[model samples]
Target chain A: MALSVQRCWNVGELSSDALRVAVAVSIEMNRDATPVADSIRLVRHSGESELLARQAFDTARRAIIRCGVNGFDLPAEKYGQWREIEMTFDPSNMRIK
Target chain B: MVRFLTLLAALWLMALPVQAQNGPLRITIDEGVIEPLPFAVPDFVAESAAAQQMAQQIARVVAADLTGTGLFREIPQDAFISQITSFNSPVQFADWRAINAQALIAGAVSMEGDGRVSVKFRLYDVFAGQEMGAGLQFDGTEQGWRRIAHKVADAVYSRITGEAPYFDSRVVFVAESGPKGERQKRLAVMDYDGANVQYLTDSRSIVLAPRFSPSGDRILYTSYETGFPRIHVLDVASVGRRVLENQPGTMSFSPRFSPDGQTVIYSLTQGGNTDIYRMPIAGGAPQRLTSAPSIETAPSFSPDGSQIVFESDRSGNQQLYIMPASGGEPRRISFGPGRYGTPVWSPRGDLIAFTKQSKGRFHIGVMRTDGSEERLLTASFLDEGPTWAPNGRVIMFTRETQGAGGQSSLYSVDITGRNLKRVRTETGASDPSWSPLQN
Candidate 1:
């Protein structure tokens, strides 16, 4: 799982490995199906204090791990060329980014 | 070539952020659209024939409590992609996700052996495809099903928001009726959502500003029972009450409890002059907190009890002032173009919510303790008496429409200045004081 996730960050690759990884996660969790972010972009809370910034980062990570429960539905045919998913997780507020 | 350069750019990005010094891609979200979290609450399953009617009603009440906040949107039953037939069945996360529901709720009702109603529920995070919290149950008299539902909603709200729940709390307020010139007021207490309203005092005499104690077991209000203004303390659970002190020469009004609930501060009027006075709740000699010729009333204590913020006319116009909990010199905090009154400190202790009147408009607003970052959440013909939810995320206040038919009602607004909603009350309610979370 670590190797697959790590390879997703390799540049210029178009393999749909990201989708396979997400689907594997979904079946492992006993989910019939789910919508996970195609990409997860970890971001920070700008102009906030250090404590607030740290909280923002933690909140973003929580959202990533939480919402990825069922997994993203990327195309299987494109699995071989897929790369890492980047999502915008803005943790300053309650709503999804 | 350009194509090769484009591929190189993509490769550059992929190779980047491997514990890079710059960190993740930087994005500034100063203000983002706040859409309510979508949730689905299927009607509670009836475990027995006696629980059939209550099963659906209880679920409706729970859904209403959450949707009323404008923080959770309920996907109507008609739009359901799948049904929850069995309460104990594992949830189909796919079905809920198809409907774009972030949260799903399932409950069941049964008749308990003790002749009471039993209600239990489980909350699931659909996208997460897992039960977010432990399932819990409540046993209560059948007639009190609404309270039980509120308890369930309170648990769900707390788990999702990571904040204290106000759904199970109560509100003490003044129920007003009749024409503006000949209005009748009564002291009343109701569930926070304005259900099961019980009147404690009739309209025989004018009553105003019913405030709940820290424990929510007692209420302090002013009444003209003896043809003069006097503060009365009432036991909430029982209908019994008594005058705080029968000061023959002075009138007392605008009472508030200290953080400890051991003392109260109110305004005392005598010889056409009004001043703020503090006294022990268990009965004691009154202590004077302010000595001035101007009228000083609506005194509220900071959450920490270290400071008192109240409205005063000492500056020639109505404005807010903060002073030490112990009697001392006062400092003015409001400088905006308006007359401010009824400054209530937030439970979070970070902001002070107040009622402001400016240019023929009244507004509910919040500002930092030191009088900074003032933001008005609502404005109307006559809005006043702002009260904070237990979590300090929302403020409920009185908004009275203009004209001869003007009637006062309760309304709430999130601190974000969005999701302004009118609270349901059986009668015209005013001066609402939200109680602390019940034990």
Candidate 2:
């Protein structure tokens, strides 16, 4: 069965390809979401399903890599079957310049 | 023949029930001071065996809450002179007035098989020799019998004093019990006189400044559970809650709802600077209201929602200021020597209650909206966070000690600096916000 996830995101621009890439990277890297700014903490509420979580991990992992975000680490794909998801992203140490 | 007629008239007069001859309606206030009516609350007469014990306990609690308000004095049963056998029994007005008790209370209690108890009470003006108001009855569970009694007392108080009664309300506060450094603070609420206490938040994280909604149904408070200061709204009935606007780097604290609960006004600290912000309860963009170099905390809305009074150090020292709810320039209202902060507008909209620090002593005081007639009500080692009673006649505040083993407790006083008393709590309590009377 597919997982259901509710996401809280920042005020950042995201194209469809970038969104796809982000989802893939998240699935591959096993991460939930990325921080867009110091003002926003994006949260994700997703259901259990190893395959779906893996897919989400892959998508988010790819997007962060393409965005050239340094120190962007994702969780493992095997731990994706969470009934509720909560994530906080910090931009204090990010090198955006 | 004459002797026989006199005997017949005496026998006819004996058939009528005896009542104190009614006197003229005399309601007068001499210099706005009426002697506290002396009232007696003997153990309530329980109609059933199930309520016999509970009825007496509830009656005592209700009596204490009323007596502590300073508007009434309990006539000790020892001096009651007359033992009331039934509610319908005649009251000897002369006997009550002889003891300087102008008012009397008599009640009956009954418990049903369904675990519900009913209380019926009446208030009589002894001097006027008549019932002053209508009789009242309340239904609740055995555990809530005390609250039912309080409601009856509050009704009598309002009818006699022409002011709303605060006895039936609840207070939300931080319940602390332990050493100073390792003290555990949990969000707890109890009846106004400190009974039926129930803890709402665990001691998992630091919680401060729990405020009741205008409707008295929800609580808005700040918690450091997520390793940062964030605001949370908890439903008092269901104990359900949701984090309010979880923005990173945004330290949200000091939340007070508007006169209407549509918007929550709180302080958000970002980049080491704190200012006031308003956010919808449903979670949306927080609109910044104040931009000042100094800290602007403790935002309280006026009764009409047109303005807000907050504490700010923009004048190089903390002082009270008033500003429009929409963005505008703030006008400083306090010019005292030491420092004034934590300005809470009264529900009556005539004055703002605040905490004033002067000469190493803190005091709870009040001033007119324009900062006139500043009256210091209580002086202590450390006093802060003045919350007003619904009627604006009394204020409840936190009193803290300043030492290695200092503790905090709640105390209340009248606006006129009369009737200062320590409010009882299950544990050391502080930051008491009196809730509005329940619907």
Candidate 3:
């Protein structure tokens, strides 16, 4: 059976602004990342303008990258299974998928 | 993936400054590790009452420009062991060396009876115990005192760095403000440091990516005044502008001038396909240079106008390509993992600065003309549009924050990718095009 997994982590010591920057860098460093709005729409169900959604998603994504910058924890035994991952983070649910 | 080295690695914060020159008075900067030469800028000797304030201010600006480069550190006046009361005074190298000042700049400011300001400065190699060159003087209107200071600083920077002076150059960029949903952008011009900013157009229309001509007196920009992007050229001195002629139903943007300032190359969009074209600066029929099914834009000419480097998606993914100036078969230059855009050829003709998107990150990077030795200088959320410094040692680009509160600002990073700093501006700024050194 095919398995899919999602994980979430706290923003850590970096302020959301810094993480947003990190996320933006991550978005920029990776060319294939969707237009910021498309990614934001996946998680933003609230009546938020594209601007607010972009900000909220950027903050959450930045948090993820900031924590991952120095290396993050993973099940070493299943490294091959989880070698690559992509997910949309929902701040409302504090969930990552 | 190539990684950028953190700036100044292995250097302790409280390390003592070294003043004694072991051999030649030079600091050859490596990839990221650099020892900023300690320098001193004493208050310029004031020759008249009107010149006193200007003298003090000039020295401060000169010091700020040098220290901001990350290649030089200015010792505070409190650490100064001796004062420069006269421009012609003999240097007391020991005193400067005591404060770990490897270089010294001494200047004199005077006011002519005709209300003009005269500024003169000399740079010294404190350890070498000699002035680097003969003292130079700049004369300008009293109201333009800052320009005079900049000229003096430019001379000092050039003498020390062995690069053409960018301190005396101006930047043309889009001044931005307001909410992300309804942003306002206007074309503006200012000194490289973002002072003396003057708006060239009103906020009623959107402006993007203003580029300076090689002569520094004319500017080309993309404007939406007619409700679609079109190229416009303006005379800097007069602030008068005229949009380049457009073929019906076509949109033109991303315009740049040739080295000779007689021709312009830009991108034109029609039938949902974009291609590069060239036209005379005085307005004439544009000669199509590229015919492709994919998008081809952001064409920049080499220093000699022999070739054009531009972005295209002729491949399944966006990549950079080089073609002859007259347009013919093209050569693919980028084979990296991600897409590249805004390939600006360096004025020195040795490298191309570009924006790279890879691994879910955006970067401002540079590479050789042949596409080897790729170095990512800065990685951020939205860094794009790299323009070369007059000397080609530095690049200035636009970096916008992510999210609603996000706004665009101008940032500069050296070609070595060692120093990254935000350029100070009164308002948010982007799409900076650095001009050639002023005549």
Candidate 4:
């Protein structure tokens, strides 16, 4: 799931400030692993300001929606286990500083 | 009893969600692709017959500006699944997503009876299925339609990337003509993208390295009008100029304004030795900042006006140094395997951009204030004189080809060494100094 969504995440689209922070998005998915529309919300962030937090969350949300358009590749038998997922996007290892 | 009841309620709430049965699946994504975000910009809606042509032209310029950054790829109009027919029409996010447009821009152009034009635009995050920011509108003269288009692009870019807007700014550069050996240079100002150029000085006298003031109202450049190199400050609006430094038997050049716009710092050569100096813009005694016996020039101020970065050859080879804005001992910041010169501090006060010559090749590079994490953005036969965009995300400089027919032109590269492009000009251009964003 992480690799599937990482392919659609473009960190270059984030600002320098946004790049320095980490954001966690909570998403509710249907049984087929497709994210429920409007179910994505920023659950937690390390950003210092509201603007930076919003920017980071938006970029994270885009990655999920863009990759989940065809539904994420996940196990159907464990649908209940992965119905609600928390994805943390951290760019500290990639940021220039 | 109350404590027991509260604990029971909390436990019940925690157990209600299905994820509570087994903690929600947590995943960490630490890596991401570094690719241009795909975007689409349809022709702006024309609100009046007079603005029909301008509506399409404005949209085209906006698209060019965004794509030129190399951070964005514009989907061709033919591939667009939905057409924006009205300014206030509902956007079909599904159509945009079908075309894989991560972002969308919709705009409208209208012309009033009094020769004024208004351009309004909205940016959308297609997959998010909503507008990225509030819609914005800019009003200006009909002749300034390009500026309006740039403004719209700037707004969209800022909202999407969280970077400051720089497209609405202007650049002051030396426009060159004639042969390479006998170049006729004049000072000229134009839009950041090299459009709507207006000459500030004629070609009769040779000019070099024009720098825009903090407010973009005046220009400081070195000229040989008096048979010797001297610094001159010119009013960008009236085209009137006066010598800023005219000490007897001394030469001064490479002038830049302090962030406050009250003082100018440049290099002054006297008695065959050069050093940096600062003086008030309103005519005051010059104060020396460096007493080095080597050539010290290309002084640029930090955004907060606390320090100045300049190039000096005191260590046997040209290198960048930083010193207190007030005269003080300087500290070397460049220790690379090459000669560095023409150091300009970034407006954001994070990095210093310079021209480096190594192994017979010239390059434009940027480094942190401490001379660490040095990255070269361009390499060519001769690339020099880097000036930062208002947002400090881009650097524009001169790149001249080799040989007798070699001519100088302006080129910009992203600080990350991407989107290297030649700026279009009527003739040869060089020594570009970008101005601050316009009011």
Ranking by TM-score: 4, 1, 3, 2
For candidate 2, give the docking quality class from DockQ: incorrect
User: What pairs collide in candidate 4?
Assistant: none
TM-score of 1: 0.82
User: In the order shown, what is each candidate's alpha-carbon RMSD?
Assistant: 8.0, 30.9, 19.4, 7.1
Per-residue lDDT of model 2, residues A33-88, tens digit only: 22232211122324143333333332232222222223222223422422122222
Please name the candidate that would achieve the greatest TM-score relative to the true structure.
Answer: 4
- Give the alpha carbon lDDT tens digit for every residue of B92-129 in model 1: 88888788777899999998656699999999867556
Candidate 4 regions off by >4 Å? Answer: B1-21
Give the per-residue lDDT digits (tens) of candidate 1, residues A1-97: 1212221221111011111111111111112222233333333234224333332332233344444444433334433323333333322232221
Q: Which of candidates 1 and 4 reaches a greater DockQ?
A: 4
Candidate ordering by lDDT (highest first) = 4, 1, 3, 2
Off by over 4 Å in 3: A1-97, B1-33
Best by DockQ: 4
Judged by lDDT, which candidate is best? Answer: 4
Q: Candidate 1: which docking quality band?
A: incorrect
The residue-by-residue lDDT of candidate 3 on B78-169, one tens digit each, is 98889999888798987986776767999999998797888888888664456766889898988787788888887877666545677878
The global Cα lDDT (0 to 1) of model 2 is 0.71
Which lDDT values do the candidates have, in the order given?
A: 0.75, 0.71, 0.74, 0.90
The number of clashing residue pairs in each candidate reads 21, 25, 16, 0
DockQ (Cα-based) for each candidate: 0.08, 0.00, 0.01, 0.44
DockQ of 2: 0.00
Worst 10 residues of 1 chain B by lDDT: B23-32
